[model samples]
Target: MTKDHVNYVYDPVVLKGRNTEHPVHPLILSRSSPREMSGEDIPDRELMALFDAARWAPSYRNAQPWRFLYAKRSTVHWQKFLDIVKPANQAWCHTASALVVVVAHKWTVDRETGKPKEIPTASFDTGAACMALALEGSGRDLVVHCMFGMDFEKAYKVFGIDRDRDGVQCMIAVGKRPALTVRDREPRVSQRNPIESFAFEGGFVKVYHK
Candidate 1:
């Protein structure tokens, strides 16, 4: 990680625009992905700690299927990993300390039939794992940005992941942020919709609720 990264204080501007209807953990409000990074290497132990958090994410049938493939900066695998990202994302990702490819197994043994069955919640469970990793990174005050603008198919080939058996979830960029100045105008934390818009009492709510 960058020098003083652990000691650096975040600018209040990052927290200015967010508000919530119901109270949540302060960390939830503070976590926002920004593209700016310090281009410094993260310690191996710190990175592993974040993955440890992901390992605990809940999965259906206890079928913990999430797999993370990563390459750290200055490593032989770094260029190969960076090359798979689309040109647009590569612009900012060049400064990232680590790049992670999230993958999940597509099948699990059916308990009843003892046969191969598609894991219905593979994507959902994998996403939960990613969120846990992201939250852990956030709590550590690290920049952990997830991106979908990469070549998903190429990831399977580059990382030797079986496309038929495993699904590529997304790519994540992890690094330390450069010092923020008063002039730095990074985007503020995003606002989320009210719960009533997505949550319902009994049945699905078809219309958009303000």
Candidate 2:
């Protein structure tokens, strides 16, 4: 584990009622995506700290090829961010505190070898960064909802991102949710699928069943 992972702490509330048979980090097992977010703005330093965690995510050969561009809610860039989202997403995401564009490059030079390394799986590396960011946001009592229902091509054009060279993975909405109302109470808590459903023991031939 990286130093950041080792130092990460989570709220006790997140651990409540989680299965003891197969222990997993509460942050990973309990994190949820809020459909509605608070309009309140997040401090710039806090946002930067989350990005810092993403920056340190492990990558193939340390290619470190993820880039993020964000627009703070209530700013001039907010409309640009909103315009890219699908109408369905706009209904909920407009209330997000911030919107970010995630980009990934397909290749990078190996620092030690001074040769270009083909990153056929750049999206996987970028996903790792997104996971780190999500965990960091959760640690701060914030929610991060990733959305792919957006005009990614248009966004790439607007942002001057070369789609041929860089891939626009998805947009992330980061914020705290508004206080839960009576109707919203039930959906506030979420659960994840059992690990046995996805995890294998030694190989694909050996399926672990709970």
Q: What residue pairs clash in candidate 2, if any at all?
A: none
Q: After superposition, how far is residue 188 of candidate 1 from its true place, in Å?
A: 2.6
For candidate 2, the per-residue lDDT at 94 reads 86
Q: For every model shown, what is its TM-score relative to the native structure?
A: 0.87, 0.83
Q: Please report how far candidate 1 places residue 100 from its true position, in Å.
A: 0.3
Give the CA lDDT, 0 to 100, for residue 6 in model 2.
29
Best by lDDT: 1
How well is each residue in 1-210 modelled by candidate 1, as lDDT tens digits? 343334423335555667778776766666778888889999997899789889899998988889899999889999998998999999999999999988998899989999998888999999999989988887787889999989988888777888889999899999987887222665555688778888899999786545
* Per-candidate local distance difference test: 0.84, 0.80
TM-score of 2: 0.83
Point to the candidate with the largest TM-score.
1
Give the per-residue lDDT digits (tens) of candidate 2, residues 4-92: 33254454544563555676778786565666677789888778888998998988888888999999997899999889999999998
